[model samples]
Target: MTQSLSPLKSFSPDSGQVKVWIRRLVWKMSIATFLLMAIGSATRVMNAGLACPDWPLCYGQFVPTQQMNLQVFLEWFHRLDAALIGMSAIALVGLSVWFRNVLPRWLPWASGFALFLIVFQGILGGLTVTELLRFDIVTAHLGTALFFFVTLLTIGACLSDFQGNNTANKLPWIGLTAASLIYLQSLLGGLVASQWALHQCFFRGDMCIVMNTHIIGVVPAALATLAAIVISWRTAALHPLIRTFANIALVLISSQILIGVATFKLHLQVAPLTVTHQAVGAALLGSLTLLTVFALRDRQSSGQYPASKLT
Candidate 1:
């Protein structure tokens, strides 16, 4: 006769279920990171980065009572959201370690890297405030945040269950190239905003060289984005959801370009438009990232298909 099954063995979820939960958690974290980016862009546009004038606390407390204002609220809430993401990142690392036996081979390493990045991101945030928003530090801070967001996006894609027919599509490389170009442009954009170069160029027309650099950067970025969309559409094996995201990248980048033109034309006078442009830029980056990830996953499936299927 067989021995009775152990309680722990009997109650534990199957490998598939554990993977599903991990994927869901990663997706949630990605969404939180996306929203955090939007809030961050808004905070910068509002000129409220120093609303708290302190790190890990506002007005030397968990919350600021004496300095409560709209700017303070925006800054405080941004920090709060970041802290939440940090806690979630740590939790993710913990869960991945605990369930390393059940997770995919790559997830644990990625999770650990994410944890490190978030810790670094928190330190950068502090430096942005404490150092009085030096242009280089602020640019680095934004760069770190974007990197963190991209990490979560990758983790989410790895844990995703979306699958379609795997095909020999060469579009994945194109997507990767496009995404990288866009990311470079994003860093430049961040620099433009942080250094007040955009305002200087738009209003005073003094910093034309930097503005011209940004303008030239947009051409390659747009071309790459267009190629990614077109290539995605041509690749029949790509999942429908991935195609949808590629289409979204096209839309967002288009809107971003238009808004960017408007921002310059209007001399950065319209606050909402400028802020929306920044948010849309981030969204564009995210969509392209997802598209690239899904495409790569499909490519992998075309080879020796793993037991753990994408769909």
Candidate 2:
């Protein structure tokens, strides 16, 4: 008689060391992704987008030998940093694929997708500079980075060993709804940044001007996120991972709003804070996307739980 392999043995948990290494790799990639986005935003804030005035190089020099000019240095340094991050991302993809048996299947795909997007984003960045920082291309570049950020977060969550209860399946819908709203808000924020619309409502001579219309859209978005948090918390049937992510989204969204108000009240002169606001928005979007993925995963894994309820 032929022996049949047991399903239980087939789906056994990965070894502790393998899980640890996967987590470490995910963390490294996350940090690199954040740094990449931050540097790109800094380049914009410093108005160094066209300092080098060349694609993939600074003033026809591979290393930018001239360090006396601050703009040229900043622009060149940003490019160098970008190259390093790209290499790191490639390494991450290799690691994920090499350890695919122990790691989640989605992790490798996410890393590969991110790598492709980064290349595309690089092309967009080059076009932005070569075209004198055309608004459309610049905005598209930012959008692409946002996509990569969310993908990285999803991969990180998948690699984690956290498993939610089977009772939490019903809450996946809530998580999906909240994620959709957060994404929409994030896209709107990107539009605002790309269009340079933050100052649209502000008249040069008007002091104590009302920003009601400009800030109105944020209210609904914030409310939807808040509702999701409350639902996740109150629903004892929800998974802890989902609840944790929901709470984080709530906190980040609140902070983002405060930063937005501060940016407006300070007459938008605070470059660092403005960039920070953008970063927080990106982080929130990424976290929510991961939360959605985790919630769905939990629903699928719920079947592994015992059929008898634990009193």
Candidate 3:
């Protein structure tokens, strides 16, 4: 005899409480992911990428001692943060698996993918130090972290209980388009950073080489954002979430463009603005990705299958 599938269980009012707990866990993971990115960025900005001159440890020690220098400390701290975040990711995967029957398959799978990406990211981090920050490895490191951040955001959104009730499905294509462009732009930004081309446009004054290359990627990104906005605005009467995310995309893209210009015009290669610009780019990319995931998810929750899968 064939095994019978389990019957669907009746909805529990306490499901809301469970969802809230999941949302909290997702937020914690998101924060951890963001902190990892910040620490990585800080290490780069501080010129401490090669401080340890080793992989998975600092100066051949699991923990540096008081005799260790500041560079060693920075590098060790970064590793510590990475380890914490990795543990957090493992916890997320465990929770997802435990709740597999209650939660959507997408939730656990997405969390697992993020966990895998974190491991890949850790390897890339080691390679970055081992190769003395080779351009290719560094670029890959940043890009991988960006991917991880986006994955975390997706899981976070999935955990939220805010399922839209609008049966009307529209602009799924636009959301996907926006996500693709944002991801491309994020990769290009990583390339710029990895190449240390931030100063490429310094001498030109009128023409910005680094900014131009970055701007080239932005063209498609902006077009995608615009398309999403137009589509969402037209369908706003049907889905308010669409409208909200559309406006958010417009605002974030505009701010990102401004930050890019400011970073170039001011010749900002260090300190607050440089870090701020980097953070803003990360935020913009993460936000766009989240919007796209949630948009598709809203459709899915409403029993309208999205045109594409996130994976």
Q: At residue 182, give the lDDT of candidate 2.
A: 63
Positional deviation of 48 in candidate 3, in angstroms?
1.2
Which clashing pairs does model 3 show? none
Pick the winner on lDDT between candidates 1 and 3. Answer: 1
What lDDT does the true structure give each of the candidates? 0.82, 0.71, 0.72
lDDT of 2 by residue, 7-126 (tens): 645655565566666567666767777777776777777787788878897778887776437667777877777677678778888877877887667778878888898788778878
- Tens digit per residue, CA lDDT, model 1, 1-311: 13466765677776788887777777787788878878888888889999888888998998887889989999999999989888988888888888888888888889999999989988989999989989888888888888888888888887876544686277778878888888888888888888888778766877678667878999999998999898878876456777888889988988999999999888777878888887888788888888888888787774333333332
Task: Compose the digit string of candidate 3's lDDT tens values, residues 219-250.
Answer: 88888878877776766434465566678778
| TM-scores, one per candidate | 0.92, 0.80, 0.81
Pick the winner on lDDT between candidates 1 and 2.
1
Off by over 4 Å in 1: 1-10, 203-205, 303-311
Record all residue pairs in model 2 with backbone atoms less than 3 Å apart, i.e. clashing: none
Point out where model 2 deviates above 4 Å.
1-19, 68-70, 99-107, 200-214, 303-311
Query: TM-score of model 1 relative to the true fold?
Result: 0.92
lDDT of 3 at 307: 38
TM-score of 3: 0.81
> Which whole-number lDDT from 0 to 100 does residue 22 have in model 3?
68
